[model samples]
Target chain A: MEPFRRLAALACPLVEANIDTDQLIPARFMKESRASGYGRFLLHDLRFDAEGAPIAGFILNDPAAADARILVAGRNFGAGSSREAAVYALVDYGVRCVIAPSFGDIFASNAVNNGLLPAVLEEAAFEALTDWMGGAPAELVVDLEARRIAYGGRDAAFSIPDAWRAKLLNGWDDIALTRQHAAAIETFARERLRAFPWVAPRTDGPRGGAQPRSPDAGETRAGGASPQSSDL
Target chain B: MPATLFDKIWDAHEILRDEEGRSLLWIDRHFVHEGSFHAFDTLAERGLSVARPDLTFGIADHYVPTAGRPRIADPKIAGMVERLAGNAARHGVQLFGLDDPRQGIVHVVGPEQGLTLPGLVMVCGDSHTATHGAFGAVAFGIGASEVAHVLATQTLWQTKPKRMRLVVDGRLAAGVTAKDLALHWIAALGADAGRGYAIEYAGPAVEALSMEARLTLCNLSIEGGARCGMVAPDATTLAALRDRPMGPAGADFDAAAADWAALTTDPDAVFDREVTIDARRIAPTVTWGVSPEEALPIDARVPDPAALVSEEAARQMRGALDYMGLAPGQKLTDVAIDRVFIGSCTNARIEDLRAAAAVLKGRRSRVPGIVSPGSTLVKRQAEAEGLDAVFTEAGLEWRDSGCSMCVGMNGDRVPAGERCASTTNRNFRGRQGPGARTHLMSPAMVAAAAVAGRLTDLRDL
Candidate 1:
């Protein structure tokens, strides 16, 4: 993950509200593993026609917006599904920042994890940025550390949680974030184990008392794992 | 201090609160599927074994075909499922692979196996993990990176979400279902109404829902931008889990039930926000546009862009109308569909099957229809009750259990330029397939649509 400090790049204005994850990158394109390149499929359905030709009218295919590194969208962008592939598609397609009035909770979390900045601006500020981009190719500056976005004599401040801001500045994945609270986590586990023993993992064996034993201790089959007849 | 069920679960799982108020929260149960293979790879890269493999469970649902249990022909999907099974084996984690009778959608299998108990904090690699919160748990989806974090440390760093309460009072009209309630709420509140909040569903209407119906409601919480949705445990909840194979028995069941009984919000507790809805006003809702919030009652006409107050709203309305190929003043019931899908974690339970089956008992569908149960158990139960026969007799393809057409990852899809009346959450563009138009509705309404070859109201049917 690269630390996000600042970027000044051409912005593509997509004024449609509720640009969900499915629209960003549909589920069918999520077949390949996370490491595979997803840029080709970013907004695949919307950007291409049935003949596999690029839809020239689409914003991403527009000659003027071809080099956009920032996307200015409407409210509630990324509002659906928890697919991190949405962020992967944007980042792989050279979109480093998305300026919106609001975002889906899970999508925003996934964005931060992938080093993509979801800069939330007020509705008026977001509209201003889009209006400016609609006129001509414009460069938008996003300063994460300063929590501000500026373009064409207009500037606005955004808000992000302190912890997430630190993670974005430090380029820290969740593993590194969790490592900072290792001692506290261990303490909590010990206390919880004693306080709620029933919630612990089922290490005593398979769930039911009458289930047949597995041929190998480590590999268990579903033969005897059906719900009881009475229960059904 | 009085705490809601969410607070009880969160406080019980909190390990530490940092200077920035982010807590290290412990995960009691972690559910994984084929989509989670990347997380396992991350753990291997770090040379870290699963910290608590016993608490983690894996299933092969996402890419597994719902028509048959044949070997997956797509190498990429096959490899992902194989990797999931291999990773689970190496870590001593239990896996329900393609051939397992227990293999099903992870959300359906978890609660069916009694693993998603009340007052536990659960996390899965899928956003619909909030389905488990219907059992009074604090559950939500985590990203792949967070998935890896939990696999390695059995904990996740988090910021507590503000709590909101939704009280739906009164009685639902006949033929209206939990799916309608969820769609109506999303339409009324807009997609981002629950953003940055954890929500609790309460009031007489929610309490009257069966456990499966409650699960259906919570399953769609993600569609509304909520972190999670929960319903407190009551007699109905206890009875639903009474003698499940994985649940407690004898004296243990008694003790557990007592604890669950106390897992309710205190009467005097206050929430960060609250909203009240009249259940009687809800109709059989259907989404007309890309967003779940763009829904209207089945009898309503397509919204006119001219009537919209804001330019942004009108722009979105025009875009949706263009993509969906719809016109203002058009009745939803008059909109023709190419197919019908009755499945997904949202409404593929045995009860949902019965509802659709009853509608299709002696009726033949004018258009093609597919029925995929939520789990193998659900499939077997439907078959035992001859619900599968009814569906097959009515020309609806009765298939095996998995997330069939809901996510379109299993090769089941609606063709381009075709419309479908579906029972799954999310009517987002290309959600079912590329250029596929989806109208979100309940299972019964989907059955009615299959018969009418258009979006038809169940009440009219």
Candidate 2:
């Protein structure tokens, strides 16, 4: 993940509230393996027509907004599904920051993990940013360490959890963050194992407690695995 | 101290609080599925095995085909399943593959096998992991990075969420189920109402629901923007866990029950926010637009954008209506549907199947429909009670357990531009398929729609 500090980039304003992950990247485009770039499919359905032609009216397709590296959307952006692909699409498409009134909990976390900044602002501040975009190039500066977004001498402050801010400043993914608490985790695991023995991990290979020769042992040749006749 | 149930659980699981007051909380149970194969691969890439494989369980739900899994026609899906199984094997994690009798949706399998217990902190790669919070646990979904984090270290770094209590007083009307309750709340309180808060569902109506129904309610908490939703454990919850395979037994069970009794919110507990709904006011609800908050009662007409409180809200409604191809004044029941789906973690339990079966007992479906049970146990139990025969006779396809048509990443999908009445939690645009319009409803309502070939009120049926 890239380290996010300060960036000044053109902003694309999409004022629709509750912009869900499904709209960010449709399910059809998600079928391909993760290796294939998702940038082409970001907002695929909304950006293209049935004939696969770009819709000129869509904001991203507009010539003026074509180089936008910051996206300004309405409240509750990324509001459905836990798909990190949404963030992948945005980051891959060169979006460095998303300014919104709020975000879906999972989507916000996924954004940080992928080095995309989900900068939250008050609804009025978000509206001010979008309004500014209507007349001129909306180039805004986002300073993560300072917790502020500024444009044309107008400054708006935002708030993020101290931990998330730290992660962004340090360019740390969750794995690295968890590593910092390794000793505490080991101790917690040991204590929890004794406190809740019933919840221990199962070593049973299959239902019968026998390891099968095939990795797909329980799976049938065709229609997948079927229940044992006795159980059925 | 008078702590809410969420606080009680979070405080108990705290390993260490960071300088920022973010706690490294221990994860007692971690559920993974095909979607999490990447996380496992990341762990392997780093040469780190799952820190506590015993605390982790994997299932092949997301990519397994519900109808004759048959080599999973999609190579990508096939690869995911194979990878999930192989990863689980290599990491010493127990996996419930497609053929495993224990296989089902990860959320359903957790509770049915007695793995979900009171006061246990659980995490899953899928968003609906909040479904486990019905057992009084502090459970929520995490992204793949967090999944890898938990795999390498059985703890998650977290900032405590403020608590909210949604109190639903009075009894629900006939034909109303937990799905309706959830939809009602989301509709009343907009989609982002629960943002930054963990919600506790309380009062008479929530307490009256069965464990399965409670799970349905909590499962949709994510839809309302809640970090997680929980119902305090009581005699009802204890009775549900009595003899389960993974649950405590004998004196241990009694001791656990006694411990669970103390898991409720203190009588004078103060919530950061509180909202009360009259359960009697709720009817069988359905979403007519692209978001869950766009829901209305089954008999209600689509909302007029002019009636909205703000121009921005009105514009949003107009856009949603345009995308859904719906008119503002159109009656919900007057809308025709090309298909119906009755399964998902939200409403695919035995009780949900029985409700759908009751509606379809002697009736035939007027359109194509599919019924995928939540888990194999649910599948077998439905068959034992002849619910499968009822569904099959009604012309709905009875398939094996998997998250079919809900996430639509699997082979099962609704064709583009088609309208569907689904029992799934999400109603986002193209959730089932590109350009596939979804109407969220209860299982019985889905059955009613299948028989009517259009959205219909269960009360009228």
Candidate 3:
């Protein structure tokens, strides 16, 4: 699928600083397969009362804030836990961009890799925007193409490393990237084996012999070679 | 023209530089946990073996079951464990498997076993690898690709990081422990103020802390966007290092101590950024929202979203308020909790357990909770001191050594929509699991919350 690039602005007010990954999707949700809808579970515990009813006083419950999309968070959004599920939850929740005074280092990278726009803005501006959005559908425009955020009578420019941006903008994962470079990688491996013969294991068969079999394909590859290495 | 501790270590480890000017640095040790399985495959695909298996260690954490001895029943998980064992054996790296007596969280085991030491560079796939900085080492977490590189070459290509000095000058107040100080710093510094920095914690407050306390302080360095948090080794460090498994003995002990003592920063060393905190004002803290920095003094009120930085931020605050089910100006203590977790590398030590046990000694908890010992040794020692009985008697489940509910990788998890007061790091929206609300705090504070079945101030309790 082509990457989803439409941007929406969040209408909720600012939360306290240091929103961590644990609170984003929680560890329990990890037990469920990724294919299961993680969206419904997002903020499942935090949004509802003990009786499972939505807390009427919460900002998300206010009708005026409906369709809120952009998230202008307090300082240090995305702390704790290394789960990429937080990114999944945010994206699934329809949050297009997160403008924070700062973000957890690892969490920011995860968000970037997962295609979430984690923008860092000055703290004062973030506070100003929070004051302006009070309980209304404040329009915040996010231009992924230009890496700029516009809203609340102001515009903010940001930067994302081109390498990471390209991955997100194209919806290509690490595996996909490797696949894209497959030919070059194969050539590099062949060349490297020739140059540093000691590093690569020797093969006994003919030069173009049928592709060597891969043993223990389904076996665990934890910290060791596969059990089928004898086949070589 | 200027020399700093960070520069000294960075220079000492530098072997060569790539054409891009990135320094190729030597790695003294590489630690792994269950979560970084992908890195192992990456190394294998490259047709390489661990460069120095003797210096590498593997532990099964992050997903090990906390309440049972049964090799995790989930086939996929079991496969992971088995694969790890096979991988370690094949590579000649020592594996501290789930049932191993020496097994524990990698960070905890490293210090306890004396594997982490002064002037060394430690790397792990887990962000909390900064926990090793208590030993006066340069420690940091690396990406899976970096982990693979370390396994194959025992070296890493690194960019120089900035250095920051967070000096706490005064004595800490009564009831204020290292956990509180870390939370307070994180709260004030906003969790990312030290991004790409190596933080050297100094001054009277840091000097007075024990090695365990220092570990706790350093453990949260990643929370502040720092690669590590380090303290110069002192007499206290020597005392702690002496009894560890790989620690110096006889004449070697004296020699090691001298080297450790010399690792301190020179008096006139400069830092890129400096922030000072008055230790006296620190109080027991607890999280009110999803992040560690979202914390407040135990008695503080929930923050008002209307007071946030931007309308979009305010909007997120609204969503956070909705998710946390909190009202503006509501006292944090009034928030009822369904569970409590007091474990993980953050707060599962004997001291942490003792503090919580003292609080729960004669108290009854209104909520269900778990107190997991960080290691088998810790579990044994706590039971010897009847700490486990104190928790069990207080209605908290005393689990075996494992990561437990801290991240809920194991089966031990709260059901959907349960609010828990946890002593572990991160109170992210659902860190413990889906529909699980976490409020992070100190072990004693978590105990207080458990007893009251709500977010209660430790001092009041």
Candidate 4:
């Protein structure tokens, strides 16, 4: 992932609230390989008609938005589905940052992991940014170090979790970071296992453990009772 | 200070807190599906293996074929299932594969197999992982990157989300269900209302819900913008967890139940936010637009954008109405549907099947539809109860389990411009397929739609 410091790029506005991940890339196109690029599939349904022709009126279809790298979106952007492919679609399509009033819990974290910034501003600030966009492409500077978005000589403060900012700025591999606390994790795991044996994975073999296969679907178990059905 | 159930679980699992106050919390359970294959790639890129493969379980459902058994007709989809199996094999992670009797939607399979337990901190790559929180678990969704991080470290670095209490008290009317309550809450509160908070569903009506219904409630928490949704464990939770092939047994089970019983919010615990609803007020609600919040009661008419309070909201409503081909003041019950789907992580359990089946018992559906159970066990249970016959006799296809039309990834798609009455959680544009419109409702409501060939109120049926 590219380390994000500062990016001043052309921006487009998609100010529809609750723009879900299914609409971001659609479910059918998620199987494609990242090597081939997910850019073309980004907002595939929104950008095209049933016949696959690009909708002339769609903002992304405009020539000015052809090089857009930032999106000023509506509240609760990327609201449904935990598909990181949603973030991949944006980054692959050259969107480096998204300014919104709020974001889906998982989508925002996914953005940081993939070097895309999820800049959260107040609803008023987001509205101002979208108004400035005014159905036309504009240039906005997203400074990760400064935690601000600069547009038309006006700067708006944005917020992201401090940890996410750190991750994006350093382009750090989380696994590598966690490994540094290996000793502490080891101790914690041991204590948890000792205290809550039932909480541990139901396994019968060595370290990697055997598959925790259950009884056949036809077999009835004697120990547990199914919940007394209320109406089912 | 009084503690919330979330705080109790978070404190128990926190290994250490970083300078940012982000805790590296141990993950007791992690679920992966076909969408998680990307995470495996990340693990390979860094030359790391799953830190606790034993705790992680894989289910092949997202892209697995619903009609076919072991044979996935489409090569691309077949590869997805194959890759999942191969990944589970390589990691030594237990997989409820395409052929496994336990195979179903990941959320459904987790709770049924006793893998999802109270007080356990769980994570999955799919958003509906919150479904397990009905058992009092602190379960939430993760992205592929965090999925990979959990695989390699068995821990996640997360800043604690503020806690919120969503209380639903009073009596729920007949035909109203957990699905209705979920949608009703989302409609009452904007889609972004629960953002940055882990919401706990409380109050008497929530308590009265069956385990299955409770699962349905927590399942759609993400739609309301909650980080996760939970219900503190009670007798109902204990009964549900009783004996599972994977859960502890005998004395161990009793011990665990005691601990789970203790996992409740203190009476004086203060939430960062609280919203209470009169359960009696929620009717059989359904979505009228793309977003979950864009819904109204069955008796209501289509909303007029002209009457909306804000210009942006009005504009968005206009777009939704345009896409839906609905005119303002049009009766919601008068809307017609092309097909119906009664399945998804949201509403595909055995109880959900029974509810739909009860509505379809002797009546034939007016339109074509599919009735896919949540899991093979759920299917077997339905078959044993003769519910399969009810669905088939009612003109609905009694298909096998997998995500099916809810995601439209495995060839079960709603055609272009067709409107469907679906029990699936999402009603987002094209969620069922390209140009497909979906109406989110309960399984019983979906069955009602099937019989009426439109989005009819279950009460009307």
Candidate achieving the largest DockQ: 4
Q: In model 1, what is chain B's TM-score?
A: 0.99
Candidate 2 local lDDT, A96-189, one digit each (tens)? 8898999999999988888888989987777777777773447889999999999988999987888888888889767776787777777777
Off by over 4 Å in 3: A1-79, A82-103, A107-232, B307-310
Error of 3 at B439 (Å): 1.5
lDDT for model 3, please: 0.72
Better of 1 and 3 by DockQ: 1
B165, model 3: CA deviation in Å? Answer: 1.0
Best TM-score among the predictions, by candidate number: 4
Clashes in model 2: which pairs? Answer: A201-B54, A223-B70, A225-B99
lDDT of 2 by residue, B19-124 (tens): 8788888898999998886687689789999988888999888878998665678777888888899999999988889878788999998887778899899999
- Candidate 1 lDDT by residue in tens digits, A1-232: 8999999888888877888888888887777765678888788888988798999878788899989998888788988887788888999999988888899988898899889998888877766677777645678888998999888787889888898888889897778667777787778878876766567543333333111111122222334333425242
Q: What is candidate 4's lDDT per residue for B372-421, written digit by digit as tens?
A: 88887777666656678888899889998999999988899999899899
- Tell me the DockQ of each model, to 2 decimals: 0.33, 0.32, 0.10, 0.39
Off by over 4 Å in 1: A201-232
Q: What is the iRMS for every candidate structure?
A: 7.1, 7.3, 16.1, 6.6
What stretches of model 2 exceed 4 Å from their correct place? A135-137, A201-232
Number of backbone collisions per candidate: 0, 3, 46, 0
Cα lDDT of candidate 1 equals: 0.85
